[model samples]
Target: MSVFTLTKEHLDVLEEKKLKSNLKLIEKIIRNDDFYSMDQKDMQYFLRVADVLYRYGKAIISDKEYDDKEIWYKENHPESHLYDVVQSDLRESGKTVKLPKKMLSTDKAYSKKEIEKWLDRILNTALNLNIDRDEIIIRVTPKLDGYAAYDDGSTLYTRGDGVNGQDITRAFKRGLKVTKSGKRGLGAGEIVINKKYFDKNLSEYFENSRNIQAAIIAEKNVDDKVKKAINDGACVFYPFSLIDNWTGHYKELLNDFDNIIEKIWNAVDYDVDGVILEAVDSQIKDNLGSTRKFHRWQIAFKRNDEAAEVEVVSVTPQTSRTGRVTPVAELVPTRISGATISRATVHHYKMVKSTGVGPGALLQVVRSGLVIPKIEKVIKPVEPQIPEYCPSCQSHLIWESDHLVCPNKSDCPAQTENTLVHFFKTLGNNDGFGPKNIEKLANLGVKHIHQVYDLKSHQFAMYGFGEKTSKNLYDQLQASQNIEIEDWRFLSAFGVSRLGGGNCEKLLQHYSLDNLFGASVEDIEKLDGFAKVSAEAIVEGLANIREEFFKVYNLGFNLSITPKLSEQQDSSSPIAGAIIVFTGTMLQGKRGDMEKHAKSLGAKVAKSVTGKTTYLVAGTKVGENKINGAKENGVKVLSEQEYLDLIAQ
Candidate 1:
């Protein structure tokens, strides 16, 4: 398929000779480097350059290439700006037209995993807001691939840069009819022609619909074919709402991901790159809210459109400060995005061995939206190279799963340094514990977390740190402790195996900091979102950290306690602190009303029954599953009359 390309004049207009030269450099580098392979950096740069051209009405790649490959790139580098940028609009026409309404980019999901995560979030939000899960409805529609414009009866404005857009009323003036029989000013819409119409009628005259679209909105006279196409009723403005869609409750959707996608994908006459899925309730949408770029309640899933294959030049093992010999692929320098990348990480020697990620191996790499390109798939296999010794300490290595482990855990200088660095980084509210200072301190025998904290302002100057730096370090330490950090963050600073920030927060929310020291593996697993394996690891890890953990805990750090169910159990109300489960249908009120009443009484009404369930209330037509689940879990299953009677008493 024909794709857009850049001209010397366009490049010159942007004063982007460096980018042009870099593309040549990338091309030259690819010849030397293995094709089907690239470091994250090269893939990243290539994506930026390619996308920049795409935004300028001169895409250098096809939709397929851009989607698949670029999807790979974005998946790898989610933190990249391209992953975060509002891609639906590419700063249309450089004119920021005031929108009739704020047309926020929909929250996006690329895979079912993310979609499920979204579902969970919606469920959690319902629980928080005291709403019934069954009542939560979601709407899925085709995300039209065309110029985004908003209409307010009189004016049509491009969704230009989100806030301001260009006046594109000319398309309407040029006889663009509304889809369906809807009147003018139906909010957001896209300028589109029927795919069948484009192929049948306009294929001979225009290269692509996108090019033809540009011409239709131009200030100049429209082409005869375009005019004829317009007269033919093939081209029209399709409003987003008027687009066909699928709507259902969460469970139905959870069971049928493909059916939902395929139906929405084939819904519209316009070209669609992805599906737009969002919760339909205004309350949920408001609670979820939008970020600076997109709505949190909704998302448009767009796979990337760029990918390339390059060879893995070689796997070079380098020791981390932790003494783990990470395998880095030193590729022949290639350009991706705006940078020159000669190296990309291969993660570990295990990946090198299992996936045949080695010299002469062809690897498919893609730039993540705006993130560093990452190795996605190995297209060709090669002999693996496993390092037997730690690259830093030269200690004998051991196997940890697929990883060739550096067994020098305790005294390994790399591990010690990294551990110290992790400590300071996790503290979060401090400066001067960054790599440069920590490296200097570690070199001077400051290996432990307490040892670093014990240093005086004057002692830092003795370590050759400037006096100013030393005082700042002292102040940062003081400030870190003074800040009212959550108890979980304090524990997370230790970097326990299963105690990342999120887990720490989750655990703390269920139990007090002091109580956690006494928590068993079983106790931890009882909490929601925790599995037995992770709980076991956390229990063991916390045991190891208890000695050191208390030492730090005693340092007068400001820690806030996480409230608990037991503490709030007695409010003299009907449902406070009770683990209530609702079942069957109700007549006095909708199931929604009963759930809300329980929440108002401060009760934890869970979706599923468990051993800890305080009361399971049955209404009418209560299923055997509800009864069996409550009985199996050892919960008190009560009839609607019995539950009401108990609550009254």
Candidate 2:
């Protein structure tokens, strides 16, 4: 079989655009089936041409393949203007008109770390605005995979190029109903067909729903199958506001991120690419505005879990900074998503031993929304290859639970180098203290982080750095100390076992940095969220790093102190510690603003009323049944004005 093929329909569409030359290049790429060798110009052209073909319902490749190439192109060329504009739909004939509102593309996030970074910006902005941290609400909705459209009451327009769109009002005339009997004028939405309906009724006649969508709005007469699908109410336009969604505080959103994502991903029957996350507060959204390409307040999390089975070449044991020996499986070079995969880490030596992950064993590797691949399952077994000694220092290894540990922490070259690297990396302000330089310094008798910081320009030159490089390195160390960083981040740089930035921030909320080191295990265990075992580990870890921490702390680094929770308490407020649920259309201001205000007045804002809820503040349009339900649950019901009056007093 050929490596890839373009359908006759796809070729005809390309030929209509006078893209015969582009088609020759595309055909050559298909025959080659190698994206690595494609030049930048060729890659960009292929993407544009592929986009046009896909929009016209004559796709030349699967969505995953196209998305992979797009991601690869973006990573390689971030400055390209190709992604700045929305992908245009080139219908054969239509007089384009300006859309009622601009339809910008969503900014994409691939991992939880990126999402957290996005949320951090929101939190920081809220802090600057004096908004309560608990008041920020995040909304998650499924990102529909369908033809993009805009319905402004009367006209149904395509998202042609985000600014101007073609009027496809003939779609409504052809009996395309709003999804769930939802009314028009709901703004931005997508034209989608129900998955089950399409599979059961239209799949045999039409290749896919995209083809049917294209036919529904064809300048020519609509196809019989497409018309029937629309008439049967199986296909409709779904507005963004009418979709099923999950809403909660930022903490609950992050704490149950996986479950929320799963729940919203399958909430609708339409095809979903991912989930959309955005801050619901108008103040926060307005403060965090938009770029030309997309809104800063909104991000789409695309989960790409592509798996490929490949044979393992070998298993190698590498020691981490914490002296935990990790089993890394070297694999026969394979492509799982867009990136090449040569190695993946086994969870531990136990997995390697039990699963027999050795040379020539077949394993399934999945790129689960990550740059790095992970072993999903073992397909074929072979004799296990477990290491008895550390590869770097030749230290005797001991089994600690499921992991092998190298006990030579005081002198293990790998451990010392990795620890030094982690410290500088976590500091995130300096550039010259990477692994190569740290490893070079380690070889030259520099064993600790303090020793690296203590090196002078002449000492660095003596340690084998060039004259200019030595001066730059010394200056960077001084700069790293002077830049103001968060205390939690600084504490996290020490690489304690149970103290990441989140836990560090939590600990610092109750205790000052000066007093944290002196806290006992019992003291730490008393704090919320810290278990006894975690407290014990944290106490031991603090003791181990106490002396070195003070040495670095005394180095005169500028640090921003974390705010104390006690300082934010408003105990004098009437609703202090009261759980309040606000609902319906607010009159005095936005519902979000009211929630924020209530939180600032020391009330605990919740999305729904429960038995423990102190009050259900109802605004205009709230149902009587909902009010009675709260009252039946032993909750006080208050009108918007009544609640405001109480808070005022």
Candidate 3:
């Protein structure tokens, strides 16, 4: 079996790479015992995959693995693109808009010596600006590990490719409040999940908080749990300006660096990967300037990964919701980095076979702060005991690529129970249908998701549930229906392959819930992100779930319909989808600012007017010939006030 399972979201990102090699080849490269001897092209492909996965929180190789490859690549090929530029986040395809301000990455420092050098640069810059070193203020704040975006009060934009980003204003519309009770338009910030809330409610369903963060900004319907978290103020847009910080002079910062870093790291409940130190003096920052990737005056301090060697007791196979069996190693209790470690995952059965990760095998494990500890290497080999049948159904297993699969998807008790559990869990408005409860019901002959929905209070009582528990379960079912949910989330709960929340929302944008089942593969492929293979899988999966989906969907739940792209394109706003050109600076804002605002409001902003121009907004210094030429082309000429008035309508 494959070591790591890639979601549709991951695949979508991979498809964009257009790599010459397939995923099978990439996995083989990752599993190779000797990375040093791999082909250069293969190594490059592996590096790209590792980079993307690391950013998405589905990192397959550890930091050391990535670093070793990177170091080797740099020494061998100094002119490679990887070394020349900063790798930006893999962005989703959408309307690209400019950020209000450039959000540059902070220069990172790993050691105290490096930090001291950075301080010298700051001091030099301070001298250049003719400011006393003692008067210079350095501010330290927790560097949040979350999705980065810019909030301009009315719109939220992803930090796409640094300068341009996709409009994610829907996050605010979904009731995501600002952290620290801060107001909007606080420039740059992160959309983060509360660590406490994630551990308690979402850890099991999602692999990491990064997954939850991505779901929040996804165009698809947000998960019910995430939606509730946003509403409860557990998830918020934490503007960097409002972050809890320690402000002190340069001397005070250097004197108590360790204590200050520790204090700021623990200051918030959000996931903080590091601490950021920046000069508060704007003049010093301007004098210091920036590189292509990072600002000169700001630096982030990151802790190193901690590793420990542990003996494996045995490897246990657990079947997941998708029928891929994961081999989890049971290790001798060993403490690593303050947390007691007893288990670590062996990526796939392929790894178990190749690496001999059997009973009594010794393994190297590393944990980076609160991140899940990963098995880095098998120190000692042992005969691997592979599973011959599905653990839950005793069905004969088969190999699908590197992963051992239980083909009994329909009848496997584990799959059915897990699917049922996922439905209610994703439907986050419900309660009492956890694993234990669902397992009990599954054992009592509840096979289908709608069957659980069909149960009454007395029926649950018949299955040996307590009277009070049965009533609560029934009430929760009612609440799941009565509480409003988005149609995209409703579709995703069906557990269809290639149709996660993101893909579901993408499809629903083009087709409504009622018409989605009937959408052909060709119809689906027409959407922006859907590739042919994914489209085929989605079409077939939808067909398989059509009956059951309609059964559950027709139960009269409160579902908000996803807005169609066509409907959005046909907006009633006067300037909606209109091509407009803004010339000369005026009183409202910068010309560039006006153009960005127009794009956010659904108007197409162009640099110059042509025959296709719908309106030409004239500012203070427009020449008479320019206005007359625009009028001659049948484009309406409007004063700045007239254009603003039209948009306000």
lDDT of 3 at 502: 64
Cα lDDT of model 2 by residue, 126-163, tens digit: 99888999899999999998889999999999987776
Give the TM-score of each candidate: 0.50, 0.49, 0.47
Once fitted onto the true fold, the runs of candidate 3 whose alpha carbons sit more than 4 angstroms away are 1-44, 61-78, 83-90, 309-649
> Which parts of model 2 are misplaced by more than 4 Å?
24-33, 58-79, 84-92, 312-649
Find the candidate with the highest lDDT and give its number: 2
- What lDDT does model 1 reach? 0.70
Ranking by lDDT: 2, 3, 1
Q: Write the per-residue lDDT of candidate 3 for residues 464-566, one digit (tens) a residue.
A: 9999999999999888899888788898887666666767877887888998888997988888998887786677667766877888889999997766766
Q: Report lDDT per candidate.
A: 0.70, 0.79, 0.77
Residues forming the 10-long window of minimal summed lDDT in candidate 2? 30-39
Per-residue CA lDDT of candidate 1, range 1-649, in tens?
Answer: 0112345644752354245646553343332322123444456666655555555445554343555456655654343556434243444445555686877766666678888998888888888888999899989899987767899999888776666688878888898888887889899988887899999888887666876766767777998888887888877888887989899988888798888888888887788879988889888877776654567778776565444676778888765553356687766565555444556667567788889988888877665333334576789999888888777667666554445545443345657776677777767678678877777888888877777778899998999989898899888988888887667668877756557666786787677788887999789889988888677667755665576667777888987654454554357786678999888887677775676567556777665555567989888998774586466456788888787776777
C-alpha displacement of 509 in model 3, angstroms? 64
Q: Candidate 2 overall Cα lDDT vs. reference?
A: 0.79
Worst 10 residues of 1 by lDDT: 28-37
